[model samples]
Target: MRHNKWWLLVLALVLGLVLTACSGASDSTEDDNAGENESAEEKVLRISSPSDIPTMDPILAEDNVSIQYTDTVYEGLYRLAPEGEIVSGIAKKDETEVSEDGLTYTFHLREDAKWENGDPVTAQDFVYGWQRAINPDNKSFYANYLMSGKIKNAAEIYAGDLEPSELGVSAPDDYTFVVELEKPVPYFESYAAFPTFLPMNKEFIEEQGDDFALKPENMLSNGPFKMTEWNAEAGWKLEKNETYWDAENVALDGINVKVIKEPDTALSNYEVGELDRVTLYGSQVNDNQTSPEYNSLAETSVFWMKFNQESKTASKYMQNENFRKALAKAFNKQAYIDVVYGNDSTPVNYFVPKGFVKHPETEEDFQQGSDVLAYDVEAAQELWATAKQELGFEEVTLTFLSGDSDVAKSISEFMKGELESNLEGLTIEPNNVPWSQQLEIMRNKEYELAVSGWGPDYKDAISFVDLWVTGGENNDIAYSNKEYDALVNAAKGELATKPVERFEAMQEAEKIALEDAAIAPIMQRKTSVLAKDYVKGMDSLNPFGNDYSFKYVDIVK
Candidate 1:
């Protein structure tokens, strides 16, 4: 009996041990499965922009497409949020400082921020970037605008007078950087958020040389994502940078960006679930305006007629103030907006787009077409007669250069008909070229009159007013006014510390620009994006163009 009892006790003890081990194993297996599921659920997002990316190199990139591409691969000291507010990026909140004169800026980099290649991101990286941009060999169109005469010898260097090393940027240590400006720019902080102002790895860039930005492996990034694939004209892909300082905040595993110029094709792809988002144009909006899947966003962009005041061949007539004014008065803005925008656009008569800036003194708003330059046939005829009489020409033939897109063609035809019908002696010609060529022609000042648009660089009145500031590279019109120049300069200098005073001065400058007929403001742009219902957190304010923040976006199931 004692032996049987002992066996039973032993059996019971062994059974209890087995049960305990099984329970522990089961819990371990469950935890492992949960982790695997979370990893499997990680998503890869796909996005699209209308234009092809020009280049990945920040120094060489100047156009909108290039700017968008750079946004994915690089980050500045600060970043502009969807709300147009400045947010810290590479630097911690405690590291930035503004000078008393507001002419100098200092930045201290966080210790954790590092390049993809395991190199620490230092202040010297920024100094190198600034020097490279202003370097005469680079010949970057955006360098002058960003430097804004700030880098000590940047202007002279651009003019071939000094070496790039003489520029104002300096780095005393790996973490400390200083930037000196030519004048006190109120929006300097916002400008710092631009991709052109981002830092680059000097060692890597120098090693790669001309072939640096050609491939994904050839470049190093400090942003949330790194370039994983680049196929030139086809498309590109971005994978989350595990080494990114704020990688925890970046939720998406990867992103694919496609360049689809044809709006219809893009829409088709979106409908088929291949594309996550697309931008709609003109009549297309009419079809989608009532749909639950469609969303229309109004961006701060002014589409206007750019006149070539510097063109020796075309400027003969375009240089005349009366000729330009006559053209502005002749065009029926209402009809143009109706035809171009259908029901989703607004007509603009002022250079400053609506919802862009408000009057600081009276709390009044400055908007497009708010102060009208009436569309009067009699007024247009009088101006045309004066221009014809002054120039002593019997017939004036002008070619308006435009993009080859369908919308662009329609706009050109509208202008040609308006000018020919309104003025007897005027013969308007249409020269439709590819969008890329159109930019070249405009930059070289080779067109008589052209259709163009100006998207804001920063959220300030100066962004618009500075375009015509005497020697501004963006001043394709060559419209020079000492009064306009003075107002712009005064605003930059006197109102650097006073936001309200600066706003008033800029408003006065914009008013003067419109009254002088610098450029004929056509209509404010309302961009339409058709996004999938699952895609969320893709939105932008007036100034910052369409930018995707993977950290905030999620794909709902």
Candidate 2:
């Protein structure tokens, strides 16, 4: 999980080539560096990270960093709470009404909800944002993937066959919004909490044009915090939005995120109290396990090896189901986790992570027996031998894509050694790039085999399962299975009302995806961070929206 923000997924970006372009005054009333006399309540939550902030605009956000910032700045009809629950944000929970038919929704916007600019956030903001996302001209990668077929006319609009104006959402007045759904989406509330569903000021966006949310000066927030600082390499900061409706509950005066690319440097700062939290890696993790400062967090992200069927180097080999299975069974998950997570993570055989969701009917884990185990070296060898003969390839060289971080590099080498040593005539070439470049290359379908990861877009399993469907937004690997698509579609459509049937459908899709070895599951990620004891209100994992919500976060110093 890039919580990398759990997007192995954001899957990482910056708005401008340089971050210094957006310098301006912060929303904070007092200077953070004033003096030692600064009260604990004035203490900014300083954290460190290895990468740069991508985009602040949710429409273009695909990586974890972008989503994280947007989550801090935007408010939707609902906001994601600690336990992945959808709580009211811009919309009033008690007043919002869903019709018995489940096709119509009436939202009563909170009159107090205001953007950072002091303008009242109205129902029109949501309509504009949703329309922009659905507009084919915007060319959103997540619009149809996340909202299509759910909202009336949304699917057609995304297909470029219908006008965006015809989309089902409408605002009769400034405070009242109505939504018409083509079908009843079971997790629609959770969907409402996603960044794509976030509201944006129509006047602000139209006036700013393309630069609407590209920089600090151009951006406006309606959430717990506002982007007070954003100098990508220099780091960024979030000051409590004084205009936010729920600012009273947002405890931290400011959040200072330092871009410390070096793990050691970040740890050093944390030790000296310059930073409240810093991520730990390598041997540092092993030493800090029992420390109260070490915050161990699990995630709903599965970092996997996605085989590109459209790739040139080894597409022929990848097309063979046996070959894909051979590659999947060749690696040792236990060994991989030890090297990567340092025994802090669990090996995953299925796409959905543990703790993601429970079986609706039995209350059993959805992943209890979904994995197809073939860890035996002998079995992998047998399968590989057959695949090699059938493909008639004496030797094959396939490229591996990964992020350039230390852990990513280490895991890349480990997988290279494991697969090359286990399978005859298999040569694994490692291509390590900046996270953003990795996404670009994968999207371009340039590699034969890619190291990919997916964090759920919502609480539902379809967030991950739909990635393997034909033409899915995140299906950069070009893997396709019609039956898997059918199951996912059925779960979202015909079986949506039947909880047990929907759950069964999702489970079946997962099984098919795994058994087919569409993507080789590596490990479910859990981040290791050195969080000060003062840092509170953040959950280890969130099944909905961003990995972490800063809305109620505080430094109890």
Candidate 3:
């Protein structure tokens, strides 16, 4: 952490607003600005989050908090545009070429792009970063989860059957980089815009060894802003990178963020000019819509409780799909939203959030055009009875792992009451844990059931749908089905180039999972924000969970 006046609050508001998010990059369709323009100077754009950044290493980032800090410093081949389009970042759009078959992508690194340390950013930098991410020895959570089969030999490398050098990405020269994918992936360019695809400074990384990315001195930035100070508990600061390739277009002079956990305190700070933006959660949302600063945006994220088929305790009945269906149908989705979220979101019966994807030919919403798994209480009871009869257990206590936050606990308690009352002889014992702890618990697959969500990393439905593939990295439920894997594989392989087939395959994959009760779809999320009038150009629709870009942000009086 750098010793300077810093704004670590970015994490506080960032986590509060974006980290809690479960889905990814959103299309910009809701902005009401008539080009009033949001800009800042001399000082930074002030935002608050409830937590500190967990890590700055892109390969190591699992949560949005870590991605926020690292993403600010790292420039990838592509960057996400305001409307959720793919724009060139380190690699210029004109210089990039895709093979006729879409199996290969070639990127030409811009000569003007340089690291914050004045070293020229090169093609090999990307090669090294890709290798490091896919290297099983580095233990990157996103490596196999995000890229595994997408990149040639990536799965083999993670499984120790092949070396990192075998991965299909390479740089023939400092200015030219080429990537070979296993198949045609229309969303691959959008994926390249993600942090996991960012380049690394090889020399600096090897010099710092394990200490790389831990401090300002050890980190390097090629993005529009560079970190000048980072205090884990105190705060962090980011200054505009003067040498950035597109620095002239950047608006902010610097960004100072602080950490504030309480909604009232954060609101108080925002009122006093101590913070520029704050997200109001739970009950804090009511009675604030009349404020000039109040703004709300529909989020692509969704919340669901994953049923663990491999229970550590004696709740083996979870392995039964009938039991899973019973639990899914027993919940009141609308009531869940009204109670847990103060009705800020909509009840969703499917895994993929609505408006996330569109039909190739008709342009209709992909989710709206598909078949849905119906939710009903009467059908739930029959499924529960049949499940119990098969398992020889009249009653079962399902252990649920959830967040320790006030709203999280309340939601869990609310669901427990609803499930127990609706389905007789059922017990839900929720073990509330901190957000970080809860993630680890689920990652380790140490819980019987857990509430978790995925924000898409890209615009495609596959971004969230791929998470449920058999043995995929985020599938902590220990749920697996050959049919599910087949449908998903078809979507990513044979159906990729054919947009209609691809959409249909994904629709089928989602159908198979939902029908089997792989996870309970509660509701799609929408965040009510007390956005400062001066805060402009911050992105809120990116489905990738990067809620905003600070480069063009401003704070005008």
Best by TM-score: 2
What digit string (tens of lDDT, one per residue) describes model 2 on residues 398-447?
A: 88877676656776898899999999898998887766677678768888
Q: Give the per-residue lDDT of model 1 (tens digit) for 1-557.
A: 00000000000010010000000000001111222344447666665544445468876555555555565578878775665567887765466888887767888888798889888888899988888888878867667655656556778988889888888889988888888877777767766776667898888998998898889888898888898877754677777888888888877777777655455766776676666676666577788888887776665555677777887776777778888788888888878766655556577777655776677666677653444355777898999899989989878788888766556677788898987999987887899875556656776788888766655666566667777889775676788989989888887776667878777777788878777777887765565667768776665432542233345666775
Which stretches of candidate 2 lie above 4 Å from their native place? 1-41, 370-373
* TM-score result, candidate 2: 0.92
Off by over 4 Å in 3: 1-41, 369-375
| CA RMSD (A), model 1 | 17.2
> Judged by lDDT relative to the true structure, which candidate is superior, 2 or 3?
2
lDDT of 3: 0.70
- TM-scores, all candidates, are 0.87, 0.92, 0.89
Candidate 1: stretches off by over 4 Å? 1-42, 360-362, 367-372, 545-551
Backbone clashes in candidate 3 total 34
The RMSD of every model to the true structure, in order and in angstroms, is 17.2, 4.7, 6.0
Error of 1 at 386 (Å): 2.6
Worst 10 residues of 2 by lDDT: 16-25
Model-by-model lDDT, in order?
A: 0.66, 0.72, 0.70
Q: In model 2, what are the clashing residue pairs, if there are any? A: 1-6, 2-5, 2-6, 3-6, 7-10, 8-11, 10-63, 10-64, 13-54, 14-54
